[model samples]
Target: MTGRRALRAVQAASGLGGLVALGAASQVWLRVAVPRDRPLPDAALALSGRTVAPLVTALAVAGLAGLVGLFATRGWGRVVLGGLLAIIGAALIAAAVPHAWAPGPAAVDDLLTRPLAGRDPTRAAVATTVPGWPLLAAGGGAVLVAAGLATVARGRRWPGMSSRFEVAGQRAGPPRAAPDGPPADAAVWDALDRGDDPTL
Candidate 1:
């Protein structure tokens, strides 16, 4: 593909990746069972990806907002933003991969303990990971990294916003004479006055 098309693709991919990460963050990543004393049933709780890794959501938001930066900036400015986007993607991957493999105690402690504050503190809760969501989040991060890398490598050659406006002006050719009341000579004079090539 041309550099312009490639840059557009990168923009699309980056936006999609951010959306995927946001969706993944809202999904359930873990299920924990809160045990109580005898004769009481264990309380089951669901922990979302946001609870497991807050950084995932934060990074996703930043990545989405960076799309505008990619479009508005150019040259070294774009390169710097691309590098920053890559770093955000890498951080998201690091934050989510661990939860995809296994649940960490520190990961669940904060959100899990909030609801069980008044209950039995000695009871052990079994935390089961639903890896689907975390895996999805990691995949999103991978996409963001790819988009950012592509931007850093080839963004300088892509057409800028001014180029698009110039292209539009060229495609417009010359203005046409009004069909109604202005005589042909009058129209020619108007074109000449405006420095437009009337013959064309």
Candidate 2:
């Protein structure tokens, strides 16, 4: 297609990718909590490891901000934003890949005694099997990275906010008051009066 149209297409793809990334991240966080029995025999269970919520949350927010910058910032600013976006995407992919395929025991492994691995583990103590959500997150991250790279390459040519979007300029000095009769005239002088104490 045309050059501008291509640029817009890239922009649109990037936005879509960012949204997917956010959704996938949320899914990972909400559905994938690893269960680990507390170190103490009687303490409450503690969860940790293989959890991507914080990273995902951070990337998701970054994705949104980068999207805004795509339209709000220009030149170097846009380029910098694009670079950051790419980094976030790369992080997502890196974070999720292992979980999807080779997910470690996460917190569950740490808490359980060697026997826990073998015993028809108690429902309360067992962690959920690594789900496919991580794969989705990784896919989303990949899209974000690709789009971000495109943005970095052609962001200068991409469209941005209109000139009208800028704040209105302020006048150099305070506005001149509307003409009132004659300045310093008798009528204007409340205390000091005119020769006749001019009728108000």
Candidate 3:
């Protein structure tokens, strides 16, 4: 692949990976903190689950779009990526605010105890005893938001092989040889030129 295409691939992969990580974290939080076994108050559970599912799905879809977009070099791909990042960032901020302002001790206790049902609660209890848990939670959320923002920024610069080819073609450089010897496989070169994997 050309340098630009490589860069775009890296950006897409990183964004996708970050989004997946964020989604997984959110899933873990939901599974742990939210009462799963007991039926939730209809409105609370439905609203909560609804809010989270979309954000996670959006992020995952955005990542996938980014990957496809990189290859297709379509404006729509960037739009999808940008939109997903924006939604994910907004969700993180919205979720974090409540956690940030929550009663520190109670919130911490709930988070800690909710996860472990029958395990030794002493160590967990001690850990939750610390102050500033809300702040910590908010900070963690902010970090995820920042990561989402970074992914969005990277998406905006989606690179492609065509641009690289134009630049390289313009530069004054030494004549290059056909790697496979004289009368090279023009088809292979053409495929590579268009950002296809020659090995495939």
Measured against the true structure, the TM-scores of the candidates, in listed sequence, are 0.77, 0.59, 0.34
| Ten contiguous residues minimizing lDDT sum, candidate 1 | 163-172
19-137 in candidate 3: lDDT tens per residue?
A: 54344434323322232232322111112222323343444444444445445543446545555545654554454344323234354454442243344333222211112332333
lDDT of 1 by residue, 37-128 (tens): 65677788888888878899999998898788888888888888888888888888898888876555555565575665345558667789
- Reference-based lDDT, residue 67, model 1: 86
**Per-candidate alpha-carbon RMSD to the true structure:** 6.3, 11.6, 11.9
Alpha carbon lDDT at 11, candidate 1: 91
Query: Which candidate ranks first by lDDT, i.e. highest?
Result: 1
Candidate 3's displacement at residue 186, Å, is 11
Candidate 2, residues 1-200, lDDT tens digits: the string is 66468566766766776677667655533222333355524223322222444576567567767766776777778778778888988987776666554334545444443443223333334334344666776777787788788878887766666544454343244544455565465345752442222333
Candidate 1 accuracy as TM-score: 0.77
Better of 2 and 3 by TM-score: 2
Q: Is candidate 1 or candidate 2 better by lDDT?
A: 1
